[model samples]
Target: MTTRELTTDVLIVGAGLGGVAAALAAADRGAQVILTEEYEWIGGQLTSQAVPPDEHPWVEEFGITARYRALRDGIRDVYRRRYPLIDDARRIDALNPGAGWVSKLCSEPRIAVGVLEEMLAPHRSTGRIRFLARRRPVAATAEGDRVTSVTLSSEIGEDDVTVRAGYVLDATETGELLPLAGIEYVTGFESRAETGEPSAPEVAQPANIQALSICFAVEHVDGGHTIAKPADYDFWREYMPSAWQGERMLSWTAPNPRTLELSTREFGPNPGDDALAVDADQSRNAGDSNLWIFRRIAARDLFESGFYQSDICLVNWPSIDYFLAPVLDEPRDVELEHYAAARQLSQSMLYWMQTEAPRPDGGTGFPGLRLRPDIMGSDDGLAQAPYHRESRRIRALTTITENDVSYEIRGDAGATRYDDSVGVGMYRIDLHPSTGGDTYIDVASTPFEIPLGALIPQRVTNLLAANKNIGTTHITNGCYRLHPVEWNIGEAAGHLAALCVAEGTTPHEVHADAARLAAYQAELDATGVERHWPEGRVYAY
Candidate 1:
């Protein structure tokens, strides 16, 4: 295999939401940008991982950048222009395309891919941006404290591509570039002594991180389409974790996020229920009463009587959360085993539904449950990759701890305001089950700002964290790892890179000099990046 060399003003090492936003921002300023993704799709969690946006209640009004809002609007436009929608459904001002009860916009993965491609079409045509799919970063070269270049390999073949850029962004899902670049970082949960988070344990658990899920989509059929029982069905069916309040692992009973009390959920389409009536605000309704509409991608009600054959829904519930082992910081073979097990667990959840799930009429076995492989572009009917909740974080100039945003710490005072704020986000500190044998650790948090210090590496001058891998501790990452926040962070990093290049300076100097920092902020304001939330508007569901 031959190695090809490429050069760009900025190179983004993960074409997820963050990478896409970063590339667009830099390329919009006339910077040559090269963005690569490990999967065929550009939107990471929104597309490849099969998880919809986990947004706050006010997403429809504000709390996201303009580019991000455009993506949302574009998804709705796809349905409006392409699909045969009812007049009432099409007339709503803030249309929820999928209306899956998980988020305001819960459309299919393919829809997101289309909208994102359209968003970046201008840059692609102008030759300012290049997007390479199915590419993964393998190695990096550094000079002093700056990353000079990175080597990427084809996931499907042996060809290697090397990219040399003026600035590099680590937007990979697991922060894979951190160790390869020899950058200082941290993973898993920090100790209470380190972060001063009330929920933190006494000792640090490097291997203890949130569980990742391999979600799948399915639709109901008239006849039986039950898949062959998964190989590990028996193992998962019989499994019961010690921390699970004595409920069967495969059952609907799981720990409630707001309160650790065990709660039971009901399954099935629950036909006749209005999709719009399903309030998704967890602070108000949790939205888990019925399984069918929870993440339904194809709601039959929105279309004409025969426009859609069956209602399609995505299965990303707690039953399939894989906490067996940490995927990163482990041997290659061990990691593969865990991934295989996670897939099996997801399949087993489907099998359980088809064979033993309880029904409203006290019946079992919905043999008509058919897996939808077309939705995910995978042969196995599962997502292209697992939904990642955490990433290797840089030990940044300023690390955001739980105390910064926790309502318990700040009360009505709200989140601690940062002088160098770059963007704003709001969400509860919602952590799922972990590989450390711990249950959910959910806490209330106020709206917070994405500090510029968090994006700048403490030692690395040219590398910037563009995703969940910012300077956020485990407790704080719970709130900072949402969709809008990650996009804001990447957009800020992209603009910072462009400004530094134009001024012949570094990010460190831009943050230090008041005049330079104000100029950068002005640039961000002109681009529609909201640096703060509305004054005194408490984030209520």
Candidate 2:
């Protein structure tokens, strides 16, 4: 019954990469910004989700927009400032100058939180920008084609704050706002007839999307004692995923045989050692050391000191991704149950490592697998939130299908010519399978642009979705659902909202006028936001 109201030019929901990008872009454009996050901290995947950067090998060279590229650079800057390596004795700046495979900022969630806070410091100082943390949208007021105001509930205190903004951007992981705002959305897969996505199943149903992950930290005990058994050990031990029928958890003792076969098929190197050795020749990472072992391995130096006081490596590998979907078919508390099952699987993997995993000459693993909760900024002994891989997509002006972007589907894909293009994203269509009985739906893709029409609602003029909620089919959603691309989408929405406010033009109008839309694209590009891939050579990693 308690409610208060505030006003802003732009309201950004979810403080993940997309939301952060929107915040930065809007604030930079001199818009009154109100950024809200359900979690206490910001930096969606990089900070709170505890997942390492799944960067393309050409990250440094090209393919991503300037803002996303800046984020990658910012991560590198953090590591360069933090570490004082022995390599500095020879080369001053060579003190852990990142890798070509991924950027240098390989630390815990807190590091990115700190980085995001620093990035927003200037905006926070200006007083025009405000961040409402631990808050989520409950309802939205729509008048004609515009959203008048949105009501949000704060977990910090039991109060509802109605934020009246010119525009509302939904950057949530599950696209939570689409349903709350009564926006029409599509869930689950689309049939081949619907999207003609070669990998698309025959019938599209509300089955599992991708499995949610409860990423945990771990450190080798060396000669220490054994780790404890997980509470739900029974359920995970009996797990046989639909997409994969291998053992519930692959580890030092057990490897996914299909992975080896896939590696051989691709002509990649074989580096499936029982333990990852920090050898001097660390440059030889082109092999499958990253592929086989890393999903479950967390580095010793990946977190801040005293954060966990243990060398906490996170467990989010291929083995423990629970194949249940939380947004669809609850099946009697699926989120809670699936999370528990995932934790048990990871913990059991740790246990097996200590009790039965192979040693140098085929002995058991070292005990004392330690975990770090400080990295995630919660005492729950797990990630702050589930590593959500997919979400409900809105039915917008243009629905990008697999044929439009997927490399497997579209050979030598060209950036679709759109007069309404507002943003750009380029990552492989990487869909980690779920309980729906699928495989790793990983498809290579070319750089693609986002159309402004895709963000506009047919019925709602005042409302625009910025996150995975936009009109992308499930097949194309695989590429659009990543950390950086989400940022570009949300940032474009923020720009569109500000334009709507200043020029009094709706998103549809902006797209309708070629001259005005061209001006908008020019403005975005002037501000370092690339709407399409510039001339660059594409390389295979």
Candidate 3:
């Protein structure tokens, strides 16, 4: 237990998008900030998880914060500056990548991470920001009521660091720090009787939550240069289900709101770097071969040209998820075991693609499906972390429940009338497959406000939640779990911490002080964070 000590105005645990946003926001407001992450990578879902961001279509014009919008634009700038756009793509453009709901502008995950680092450069140079990568919080020191310091430990090093700050933000993937800090946190799910959430399990079982995905990239190389098979290829080959396509091999599935069942399609493309014209209608019209392929590979041709090979494939079919029931309660070597399982998941998806996917001529498995390790890099051609849709939510002053904000119950939205709005989030109600049951739970959502109370924990005087783990119910979590919304929560938390340090006021006081809270809302608004939806189509989500 070798321990060292340090001090800062604010300390943040976890360097995911939310934590990163918090660090940047607080530091920019002249607060010294120290942030820690378990992984070497910074961007959580956007980078490490290989999740081509789950951004709303209108984000470029009006969805999230100015900071978030800047980050989004930065990703595009990277592509424009580094890659090449084809003549047609460049010429007739309203070029949104993936032709899907998620990322409007898609690029390699690394690009997003690089841009995030650049955004924090000025603050780092000024000593306002310090990144303690590969470290986890060991303990949280509190005095009377306020958090005084936090001890962080790194597995590789002998020395541990203690961070003292006015405010502490918990952005750990699983609310890892909340427990260490003695914060009141909730795990798994609450029973339907408890929260009255239709989606909540009939019985309360917190551990049975959504499973994580370990995604990878691929390329359809011409000729016979298919990549070598993954190490645990057999386990993946045997993974098949009645609900999936082609023996549960490479398949495309999206949550259909009308049917509540996943509509899956078999996807395969020949000669990796090919281009298909996709329109706003979500229609692909590159003629026969494209209609034949219609697969959502990283069609590099969709990007601005000069990007060397507009030909990398992204493997995110629903086939490879590390299902929850099987490994949710693995008591032995959980992290390592999960990693092993996750890798097997990615390899399994690839195996399914390579050796089991359904081809156009009704063939099973396109052995030509190659894993481009160099593209996604070292963490076994997959992301360094798993795609986490839900996590340990804190028991806060106000637990945002489905009754307060679910599309199924609201018909519109439950939390549409938030007066203490710090930010707003709007997305289709999208509950991913959970161990409780396989339910998409997709429904229309009214643009809703995020109450500041949801971000503040009930017990921790100085600690706050800055990720999807914010005080949302299991049901409401579906709408608030996307990338931009998490960034909004984090940015607001950062600004809140800065305000607390400056005014010597606790989050509770600020909430109580309508005058001061209004001022804070003003600041957030001036920073281009929408506390309320505008008076038009924007409001009509």
Candidate 4:
């Protein structure tokens, strides 16, 4: 109804992990920042999306930025200080509160929200960083080659806010600001001829985006906590994906991402496995063999005896992946419909588990499975947002293709080294089933570099790709879209924006000039941003 105007040195739209990292980095560098989020919580994948970090093998020791390490440490310290952990867990340096196999540090999403807020507390207190929650970007004003302002409408029916900034960062999931700003961006799959990526399809399928999953938390306990059957239960239960080899979508049996084999995963709630023995090394073990321990967030054995009646396991399994439709670049009503369908799919999966899912001991159903809404910070028990694996990528000066990172393509040469490298990340090319009826396109990849050119759009003068929206092809997006990589991308974008503001320069200018680029990278080095991997320490896949 009403309009409000605000100005900042840096405006980050989307308070996800990347957006939060960007805000902190910009604010720490003495830039006035305005960070906004559509959700009530800030952390994207960690909080709103409710997906644990899928990190590299060396995550505990290296290959991450200093700020990211601090966030991880903060998560662990939260459990050590507040939660009732056992003596061994309390003493261990890297105590996984969730003890989830997906990541080294998997805990409650709300915990990540607290840690992220605390990380931005000092900046917020000093008025350097202003966080606007429950605000979604609706419009943008671009002047020739620059985004002058972005208009955000309030979700809670407050006044519409227009943010004018020296530099704008598109950190939203699905790259929400790209189209609004009239930026040149690509969505869905690129053609094999277009990208020369082996994994790319023969023809470009713009509507064939990766499957989005609506995650939820559940714990097994006494008594029946069976939820009402979802309306689409019959449709989902009877559905068998072609790639799944006749396995029902709601069942525990599904095709493995890497192998594509019909792997039957085991599920048993409160199976008192030694939580301390969980070695979450994905490179060595995919860890999805057991649906229960695969993403167990809170192992009861990790805490004091009887502190937890059952292990809190997050349901982000393959069974719940919603590939029926693409959520991005659709009409508002259509997008909402897809999201509702995704929710139904997740709920249907839960209902199936509670009613008809096959047990390890030849029984059927685990009626004791209870949804934990408090853990996810949602009333309906589902996550605040869907886990989006891909985003609208900006057409940049340097687009990272599968040829650059694929281990099979590069061989002993390692990944393509970047002269304008801003950071480093590593993950396999892990594309899930798409709306185009495509199966998983998983491929081993080498540790890769994030070039400054990837962050800078080809035509946009003041806007930066701060999340999975960088100059990465659909094939390469799989590896670059992980938690640490996204954080690094955002951090680099924020720091670059701050540096540009301080230096009275544009991103293109800094990137084109070798000296300026080197100086900017030096600042990143000083801040503990790993610009390059070790000379000999290269790991494939």
Pick the lDDT winner.
4
Judged by lDDT against the true structure, how good is candidate 1? 0.87
Off by over 4 Å in 3: 91-101, 223-233, 240-262, 270-297, 303-310, 325-332, 412-415, 538-541
Candidate whose TM-score is highest: 4
Question: Which ranges in model 2 have alpha carbons more than 4 Å from their true place?
Answer: 88-105, 221-227, 250-312, 328-341, 413-415
Q: Compared with the true structure, what per-residue lDDT tens digits does model 2 show for residues 309-378?
A: 3334555666567675454435336656766666666677656656665555655665655555665687
How does model 3 score by TM-score? Answer: 0.89
- How would you encode candidate 4's per-residue C-alpha lDDT over 141-250 as one tens digit per residue? 99999999999999998999999999999999899999998999999999999999878889998889999999999999999999998999999999998889877888
Model 1 over residues 5-89: C-alpha lDDT tens digits? 9998899999888888898898887788999999878889889998888898888888899989999888988899999988888
The candidate, 1 or 2, that scores higher on TM-score is 1
Model 3: how far is 64 from its true place, Å? 0.8
Error of 4 at 266 (Å): 0.3
TM-score of each: 0.98, 0.86, 0.89, 0.99
> 274-321 in candidate 3: lDDT tens per residue?
344443221122111232233243565565554434356565545666
Clashing residue pairs in candidate 1 are none
